[model samples]
Target: MAQLSDDCFAFGGDLMPVHAALDLLRSRVAPVTAAETVPLADALGRVLAEDVVAPFDVPPHDNSAVDGYAVFFDDLQADGETVLPVTGRVAAGHLLGREGRRGEAVRIFTGAPMPAGFDTVLMQEDCRPIKDANDGDSVAIPAGIKRGANRRKAGEDVTRGSVVLATGRRLRPEDVGLAASLGRKELSVRRPLRAAVFSTGDEVREPGQELPQGCIYDANRFALIAALRQLGCAVTDLGILPDRLEAITEALERAAAEHDVLITSGGMSTGEEDHVKAAVEALGALHFWRLAIKPGRPVALGQVRDAVFVGLPGNPVAVMVTFLRIARPILLRLMGAEESEPRLFPVKAAFAYKKKAGRREYVRARLARGEDGALTAVKHPRDGAGVLSSLVESDGLVELPEDLSRLEPGMTVEFLPLSEVR
Candidate 1:
């Protein structure tokens, strides 16, 4: 089993800053070293454990880009229209047996390897057919048809011996298609990380269950499970655990022994009912972090046996926000991905708001084309961490860094799409 560094992460001084805590967490994790070969069908979202090197040049040889006539550029009449005798036909998988003569052209289709001695192709639309006595059929080509036009050169897309996909990359659809284009039947990827997700509040009931007075539906667990599935983890849904300390403790211990990671929500707060932190501390080492961030002001990271524990808060919005801000990167690292940080794009803010210094905040916002034609982030009206509707209504989070306390309209800020995390 992969393990984090023996020395615990640093958090003794003041409350850990967001970036500092993230760095410490990632630095301590050692990506899983195990690897297995899987067919391309099952490779999506799997981290590559080996660099995919192209054994041969893509296209294998120069080929036609369209159905047209292939000719030597030098053979074309530069001053005016040039007529050439049609020699033979070539389709995607078919090639002419012999090289073309200077005064002749090969009728070629898309993806057909360029016949020897031919370096240019003219689309069928650009050439007119002409009758010929000796050659039987010929083509009238216009002048100024540049050399190498309408042809895909061998190795243009991918060169031989080049590393096409590097190790630690999570395979996307395009990446899988690329491997197929290079004739790769299978890929070496890291084993999928196993995770268990559950809730621990007696007040949190399933959606279909008859709602008792003062009881709410458990929404965070389902969302967390979905996100884990999207990240390619084999998730074991533990459902809602009983609120008893002994029950939660036993569940945590069992999950720790079985899964690589244990993710639980609603028990990291300071309330007396919170039992996740206590259970984790009793079973293993737990580090509670007061990260300088809004929505998610507190988070807990710990290890139980060989499994990592990510304790998330209860508020629906806070759960999603904290998961994206902290748990996402740590889980990615545990999955053997070297680059776990989500992509953030810069856009202008459309609203004004005052913020406190020394805390990073994620404002729910949607992008719109302003009257000036520039992309701007329109803030959702509500900023409450409990308002899960804001997360659903907005496209992403507009991250306000920890330095500036004031944000005026048109100020540029980093926007992280919800898609980035899942």
Candidate 2:
């Protein structure tokens, strides 16, 4: 059984800055368990736990890049076309037995290993064959051809003993192909982080249930679970917990005991029915931080035993925002993943908006390129946190800086791509 301390629950002073809180959270987390094995086909998206070094050159030998004649460049007639005797034919996977003799050319096809003493290849389309004393025995080579042209040299792509992939690289399809090219049958990768997800609040009902006058179905849990899966986490859906201290506490205890991290939405704010904070405090520690961000002002971060706890807002948009802004970094750290800064691009604002300083705001916006070829962002009609339909119609989020009070049309603002958010 795991245990938690209440040391973080004593929030007696002003809330800490988001960056500062994140630093503290990251410093306290330990790396997850890791293992290594051969998973050539199923290794995509797994984080590399060790560096991969190449044992051999990518191209084992110099090979022909085209179907042509292999020749010694020095023997070519510089003034005009030079005719040479065709020594032998070399195709892919078959090499000429002996080195090329002076004034003799080897007839080679694409991917044929370059014979010794041969330095250049003339494409079959670039040369005209001439008849010799013995038909099919000799051919004429063209002049003005450079040395080493159309020849793929060995060790060009990857050299032996070179570091092909560093630790913490997430293996993608291309990475897997590269590893296969290097003859790697196995890879060492960090274990996927196990996350237990649940939702709270008496007013929240599971989908397919009849909704009461003031109740709504739980959507955050499913959304978060899908997002977690996309992030390569092994997620366990713990379902919904009522707004009762005992029930919430029991769920937290069970989750902490079985999972690497526990995540819950709603019931962390100051409402009378909010029991998530109390349950976290009773289990271990709870740190409720007022994020200087619109829509998602209340966010919680703490730990229960060895399992990390993240509390997201009940509002749909707030849940999405807080998870991307805060939870993503911590989860990646726990998984021993490399840190990649979110890609932000500049887009011209198409509408004017008013906001206060000292609070970050992410507005759902649709992007379009104007007739003049300038990219522009237009705000969604509804800015409410519950308008999830807006997100479905938007391309990405327009980031309003913490110091900006108003945004005017044609002003350049940073845009966070939705691809990066999930």
Candidate 3:
């Protein structure tokens, strides 16, 4: 398992701003996972461990960009059509056997290498072909065609000895294709982060089990496990731990020994039955970071020995939001990914909202297209933090910044799509 070098991410403030918390995380966290080599077929979504350099030019030779006739540009007539004999033919893979003289034309197809001494191409549609008794085959070239118009120069896409992909970048499908184009079979990448997820609270029960009057099915654990898996983490489900100090402590100790990070939901607040805080404090360091954000105000971060620990809120919606916005970045950094923020798009608001000026808020909303083909964000009817169904009904969240106190309709606001993070 990967481990932290030191435990230095503790904030003493009662409430911290969202940006300040993210900035602190970026400065304090470092990648803990080791590097490994994997084939190109299995490289997608993995963080690159080293830079990839191009060995040679992308298209090793100058080639024709279209099916046409190749010839010397100076041979064409300046005033009218010029007829030249079609002395040779070339296709995608085949090349002309020998160099040609100035007055000769070669029938060439797209991606065919340009023959020696040839500097121009005329499209087949613009040139007329003729057959005669004296001349075997010839094409009538238009005088106004530009010189070198249909030729593709070598190294136009990529140059030799240039860095094509940098370290700490998460490989995408196009990145893999580029590596294949460079004739690379495998890539060096960071190993996936090992994570263990569980839920606490005596009122929580498994989905298939019978629930008592005050008990509810465990949704946070399953949700967290799925989210962690989506982020390419090797997630182990520790099940639901009862709200007992000793039981929680023992389970956490065993899990911390095997995993890089331990994630738990609920039992983070200062309540009588919340034994998670006490248990984590006994086994490791627990720092409660009271964020000024709604729904996920109570979050804990610390370490057990060498493994990192994260305690999130109990509500399902808060669990998803906090995980996506906060814990996701931290885990990504530990997995060797760059500290980058998710892209937020601007869209017109279709609802009015009032919020505290100093706290950041994310409102669940869906987009609707007007008759003019403009997208407008429509806020969800339900606003409760426990309303998990609202997240399902909406497409993403309308991010209200700390300075904004009121949101009116038709105003442009930054929107964070769930697809961007999840």
Ranking by TM-score: 1, 3, 2
Identify the runs in model 3 with alpha carbons over 4 angstroms from their true place.
1-13, 77-80
**Rank ordering of all candidates by lDDT, starting from the highest:** 3, 1, 2
Clashing pairs in 1: none
Candidate number of the best TM-score: 1
How close to the true structure is residue 278 of candidate 1, measured as C-alpha lDDT?
A: 83
Candidate 3, 1-422: lDDT as tens digits: 86654412222355788887788777767899999999999999899999999999988888999999999999999899999999999999997988868899999999999998899989999999989898699999988988888999889878999999999998889999999999999999999999999999999999999989999999899989988988889999999998888899999999999999999999887778888888888888865466777768777777887788888988999888888888998898889886457899999999999987877889999999966789999999998888999999999999899899999999999999999986
lDDT of 2 by residue, 1-422 (tens): 74665433223445445666677777776667576675878788888899999899979889999999999999999889888888799999998988878888889999999998898999989887777665766667777889899999998889999999988887889999999998888888988889999998888899999999999999899999998998889999999998898999998998898899898889877778998888888878866456667668668888887788999988998898778878887788888777644788998999999986766788999989876898899899998888888888999899897789999999999998888755
Once fitted onto the true fold, the runs of candidate 1 whose alpha carbons sit more than 4 angstroms away are 1-14, 133-135
Cα lDDT of model 1 by residue, 1-422, tens digit: 95555422222345667888798887676775479999998899999999999999997999999999999999988889998889799999887988878888989999999888899999999999988676499999999888889989999899999999999999999999999999999999999898999998989999899999999999999989988998999899999997778999999899988898999888876668888888888899875555777777658788877889898888889899989889989899999996899999999999998876877888999989989998899999998878999999999999999898999998899999887777
What lDDT is reached at residue 266 by model 3?
93
